[model samples]
Target: MAEVSAEARIEAPAEKVWAKLTDFSVYGEWNATHTSFPKGPPASLEVGGQFEENMKLMGFPAEVTWTVEDLADTRTLAIRGKGPMGVNVGTRYTLTADGDATTVRVDGEFTGAAVSLMAGKLKDSATAALNESLRKLAGLVT
Candidate 1:
């Protein structure tokens, strides 16, 4: 398994940050790994909601079928997905408000046989992607 995380303090309120985070319509605008949503964003965002996302990770393109595992308005969102080559992917977004600023953290994990073959490289790539995603997200909201 490979795990990665990134955190950033954005000069914006939690509400503003959450709006941009959950707005899948413009997800690609800031999300570094996102290539496109083949069927668009999910109609509703709730536990069990499913969506298909086309993503590029570790320099490879993949289609992942994701299910919303958890959600909390303006606070948290977690999703688990099944990717190619029997890989399992999990991502979580967390937001904490501190007066006028919001601290956002993204956590990700990849597990499967494929991951074992490239754990080190995958961690490096994923960590970079998460940091880039957070930077872009901050630019949009702050």
Candidate 2:
């Protein structure tokens, strides 16, 4: 399995950050790297709720399905998802209050046939994307 983890400190409160993070609909607005996403069957963000999205990964368009596996109000959120590219992605977002700011960490594990071959490249790419997205997300919240 290939994995990547990136973190950033945003000048916002945990609650504020969590509110925005949990609202999956606005992901496109903040996450510049992702393009396509599901349209209908509006999904709720419950522990077991699921959502589907289409996005470009490694220059290829792929469909991904994500299921909420854990939630911790304003602290952490975790999900398990799979993409049409034969990639299984496990993602986790953790928020920690730091004096008047919030430290956000986004980590992911990419597994399966597609990712198993180029483990180093996959990890590097995911880390880059996550870092970029975290910077953008921090800017949005702050």
Residue 127 lDDT in candidate 2: 85
Give one digit per residue, the lDDT tens place, for model 1 in 1-142: 9999999999999999999999988899999999998988887799999999999998899999999999999999999999999999999999999999999999999999999999999999999999999999999998
lDDT for model 2, on a 0 to 1 scale?
0.81
Q: Which stretches of model 2 miss by more than 4 angstroms?
A: none
RMSD of each: 0.6, 1.6
Q: Over the stretch 42-116, how does candidate 2's per-residue lDDT look in tens digits?
A: 366789888777766566677778898998999988989888767898989999999888999998998898787
**By lDDT, who's the top model here?**
1
- How large an RMSD does model 2 have? 1.6
TM-scores, each model vs. reference:
0.98, 0.91
